[model samples]
Target: MKVVNENLPEEKPRHLLGIGEPEDIVEGVRLGCDTFDCVAPTRIGRTGTIYIHRNGKLEKTSLRKPEYQRDFSRLDEGCDCAVCEKYTKAYVCHLVRSGEILGGHLCSIHNLYTIVNFTNKLRDEILHS
Candidate 1:
């Protein structure tokens, strides 16, 4: 991590790489990381992947299955992001099923939003802490 941070521009915001889990993001923020990116969400989404949150526990959906063909729901109901607001699970699932480029893009957008937004929130938390 030190080596990677050393290579970044001193004037630029410091970000931690390969962050995935929500808790990991929080830790990175505590460590002064201002940015983070991960491929898990999209990589998994392209395969009919879904994410479920229940009792504060995260459940990842696996793509390589036929069940998502008709399941319709927001990827994360708690998420008010564009993808969750304007899209449906069934549609995204279909896009993935049909090998549509939009599917991955949409998923990537959401995933990016989730990470970036979470990081921002973490920053806010740190400022107040």
Candidate 2:
């Protein structure tokens, strides 16, 4: 990235493709990347996994695991999206374990929402700093 940045105009935006982890995004931004995109959030959500922001970092959890069987909680306590607003962890866990399509759909919704919210917060912090 240092080498790449050296050859580009400072005022121009640099897009970092196929990178999406919060930590990676921060690193890429510091190294001159001004944009990023990836299918990981949706892909992982399809597999019954989702991201959550925790302790100032991104954390992931699998809904198919037995641990969620009795746990009743929203996908994200801080999220107010349709999925998080109406679904419980136990329900989503059942959907995933039962091979229901709505499981993936709900997961996708939360994953995308999480990323979008995180980015918005990031932008606000950057602007304020």
TM per candidate comes to: 0.68, 0.92
- Model 2: per-residue Cα lDDT at residue 7: 97
lDDT of 2 by residue, 69-103 (tens): 99898887777889998999999999999999999
What is the lDDT for 38 in model 1?
78
lDDT for each candidate structure: 0.69, 0.86
Question: Against the hidden true structure, what lDDT does model 2 obtain?
Answer: 0.86
Q: Looking at candidate 1, what is the lDDT of residue 80? A: 73
lDDT of 1 at 115: 58
- Report residue 95 deviation for candidate 2 (angstroms): 0.8
| Residue 51 alpha-carbon offset, candidate 1, angstroms | 5.2
Number of backbone collisions per candidate, in order? Answer: 1, 0
lDDT (Cα, 0-100) at 93 in candidate 1: 77
Best by lDDT: 2
User: Residue 5 in candidate 2 has what lDDT?
Assistant: 87
Candidate 2 residues lying further than 4 Å off, grouped into runs, are none
Model 1 Cα lDDT, one tens digit per residue, 3-49: 66567777889766677777776666555567777777677655556
